[model samples]
Target: MRGRFSQAWSDVLRGSAFPHEGQAFLEQVFSADVFRPRPDHGGREERFALTYERLRHINDRVREAGSTVPLVQDRERLFPLLAWSAVADPALFYAMFLHHCMTTGAVLEFGAGREDLADVLEELAATERVGALLMTELGHGNSNASVRTVAEYDADREEFVLRTPEPAAVKFPPAVAAEGVPRLAVVLAQLVVDGAECGEFCFLVPLRDADGPLPGVGVRPLQPSPWLPLDGAVVSFDGVRIPYRFWLRDNAVLTADGGFTDPFGSPAIRARRTLSLIRFAWEAAVVGLAATAGASAAVAVRHAHRRRTGGRFAAGRPVIRYRNQQRALFGALSGAYVARLVAAATAGPEAPALTPRSVRTTFLMKVVTDRIAERVSARARTASGALGFLAANRFLDYQGFAHSLNAAAADNQMLLLDGAQALLAGTAYTPPADEAPAAGDRDLLDPATWETLAAVRERILHQELADGLRKATGSGLAPFDAWNGLYDLAERLAETHAARLVLGTVREAVREVAGSDPVTGPEAAGILRDLLALHALEELAGHDGWYLAEGLLDADEVRGIPALLDRLCERLEPYAEELAEALGVPYPLVGAPIAGEDYVGGLAGTAPSSGTA
Candidate 1:
């Protein structure tokens, strides 16, 4: 049981040395008493205090360890721990909040040509200062281009006066709030120079010092949210003044004569460029959601292996052996794999920067991962029965994470629609000449077959969408009304495109494993291939109607997907533990006592139960 798993685990460890080291360090620190939350606390305030203290200790330890601060220098190592931290305590995970600051600062230095701010960024990173991004407002939400917060330039004073003109202009959802911990913030405000609205830009404003809020800054903590443990609040500026040099003039510049000049012709273009800082949040969200899905699946699978139900068998079989159980739990396991692989591919070092293509990719991947994590968490919860509802299992926490992720960075629906618009405006898909195996003629397990099926499905969805839009417009409907009428179709197009992308990614991963060292490669590839098949088949099973309507599959072939999924599940059952372990989910992060090997005995507080047979 351990041979293939051990080999694959070793391969992962060897492939990324930093994550191994980082995991070790995290396990050590997380084991400390100071890091644990006091769940028995009677009130929300007490719980919040304990959580806050634990977070502070963790931050102190991170600083002491000299890990990547402000900006991630080595994501391969730090990302794993970040993922684990998100699972363990999402509140503590919020403490590592310098990435956007670093990104905004970098954009200013490179894109805005504010080269002089480079040293400031380095100092912020080195000092490990907590930096908040104040962009989202009560009125605008994620529509940063229309924010009412203004940063008007003062020529003689050579400073920018930040003001929230109305109640709606107050920046909400800032993690710092009244905590007074975040000493600085990259405030996104409309750049007004000489009475001209130049557009949105980032300015490094001192939010607080050791003594507390700056002269004209007010931080009012928002009503507590039951889901996210982090403190969030509305930050209002009452004529807060900062030096002109604090402006992150990435695509725009302030002239000496109190004039603004930008390469982009319009304020809207510059505002869009400035809002690209959200990419960091999107990447972090992808990694965090993948980890959440992996951990949820691990807990569900472990519980399934331990829990038993009596039936026609002599004693009883593990719940995982049940077809329904396998369908619910194993499907989630496949989703976890898909999310992790897609996140890894999207967030790699060489990934493109802040372009329209990169932004769309990030948005699509983030939405996909969030949706997968949510579905997997729900399935995991259902599979675990009563055990999943217990606080000790952290299923509820995982559920909260799913909701928070969907709402974080930007609303998931909004992001999906944004991606849809980009897709529609770009090139239309050209369907291949029936590359997929006809009905019963293809090998369901073949990677090529799965790739072709996914690609063809995506193409079909795209073509159908294009035809629908053309017809809608041709019928004399306004463009916006036509799009609004086809909102559901647009969403389906985005989902289909995402599905195709993830399937392609998994196919490549399987091929890589197969082509590696002959010793472990074959075993790893075989297991991954089954997972890939299950993923593809499950998807096809869900969308069988679409396939049938598009003439991509016959009724018999569509009906066969369920049986194929069951066969795949059975072949992979013996290696379920190994598959979950390969996801690199730390054992302690499982956060459920039922995941233990002797959960049956432990639950009874006695000898092992014969039912576990």
Candidate 2:
């Protein structure tokens, strides 16, 4: 099994064109059942679904090409600007959930014990097969608001009988991954005990393991398209008994005695824990989008700068030089780094329990990530002009997948509202008047740590202020520049949050390490402080005039920000490669093809493109 990403990446850089099967398959993927209001040709639905199918197909090809890097790591190549189209057009998003279920390998991980599916998934994982998580039924998506599929505990038989009682309850629209005869899927259903609903959990079901379907696991395509294969449809369960351990066990668990035990402390804690896994995985995907777009911008801008303009239908010399193009590519460039910087700041392995404010802060970074991918990718297509539309070059397809991924990954507004609810929710959960630390508890508060947390709050407030001012001021600055300013502010706020978490976590790690040098620790601490100050200052500079006029800071502080920001950018710039290294695979989630060793030639003699062409 190819485990290393750098080697796996070489499979990413091959020709960006769709496969012949893929082109023939597209009409089925882009069908009316899938596209809805969007057109089948050249429209938003066509572009968005095409992008997802192509990128997913690329991952398949790359896996076949023997790239060790995970498909998630090579996201920059798979999901591009088309993600923007997904948010605007419903059709793109419609296929997104199904795409994720297929591409992500959900079924194989959770539904492993069902003999046929398990064998198929093991082979796929060993050989780089695309996988999907199939928990969301036609009856429910995020909310298990109501589920009807039953997996009855059969103690005597030593197996659970999985059954779908009604058509509405069946797993409808399992989508394209199922269309090509998939490798694996995690099927979600409720556990029944004498007609009472115990809870919901995922059962890993392998569809097309190494050979074919597991017995009793029926599979079929839903909507067909002219452009891509999006056969997300339904499947049924007729007393299909899977082994007990096939449950994901992330939240609710089945006891040996047949009772259910949720050991994550409380029902609320358990719920949050489950959501945490989902949020973390999806957030990782969001970050992947940023990394992908940033890498694409680096290459496209460099290429644009080199290419001469003014041929028939040509975008003039050096597209990035155009303010509008700069607005798109450079704006995204800043955003990806900013989001990365923020994620690093807010989330350390041992960070404090999220204050309501902290949860909102982290979740918001995810929102910005999703939104920025959508916004910038669309702009990238427009910036590329006709070239952006060509399936061979594949900017359009890349953009489409990004669009759908962002749109369906989770609704941004819903998530933002949820985060806000969680943040403000603390008041209801804890008595507001007694929330502050008690006397003598002051010693428990690490001074710098508290200051960092407080600073995070203040910094976010400042960004909110900046965004509001930008729209209110209507300064007529270019939209890209305006957004860049807003993102810089958001970026720093993100970093401030990340820095606090990392530093706060270091204290715990140091205590565990025992003899670690104190001097080195503080120096490292300084590095984190520098990170917060740097990105935050970049944000502050964008609206320095507003700050000065508003009396938020004196002229010296106002004037000093640019110098301070430049200083920080330069300092961090030197450490950028190290930063990338420190981030590990988490940083590569954005899906750009180039980040892996495959594109840059870590191993001699392998082709660099995504392998399928």
Tens-digit lDDT track of model 1 for 1-613: 3555455533432233234556577787677776443334446555545555655565556667776533354556446656766777666555553433244344444345456776666645544445667888998776665888999999999999999999999998877653435467888899888888888888888888756687899888777676776667789999999887787776566777787779988888887777677776777788778878888997788778878887777358889888888888889998888888877777664436556777877888999898889899899998999888876676777778888877777888888788777787773423444465676677778878777877787676667778989999999999898888888888887887777777778787777777676777877788878976777887778888987887878888888888888888889888887777677666554446677777766557675321121
lDDT of 1 at 365: 91
lDDT of each: 0.72, 0.45
Residue 269, model 1: lDDT of 82
TM-score of 1: 0.89
In Å, residue 1's CA in model 1 sits off its true spot by: 6.9
The whole-model C-alpha lDDT of candidate 2 against the native structure comes to: 0.45
Q: Candidate 1, after superposition: displacement of residue 279 in Å?
A: 1.2
lDDT of 2 by residue, 1-613 (tens): 1222212111111112212233223333333233232223464335534544543543344455565543323333223212322322323333332334233434433333445455544444443343454544566654544667787887666567888787667775555333233355566677675555666666655555444456776665455443333445567767677776665555466656676666654544543433343443453444345444444444343334433456465556544344445444444444444444433333332333545555555566666655555555565556656654544333454465455454344555556445433322243232112122333342212434333433445455544645554684497777556545544444444444433443443333223222234444454434434444443344446556754565544677666655555554545443333322322221122222333334323213365533111
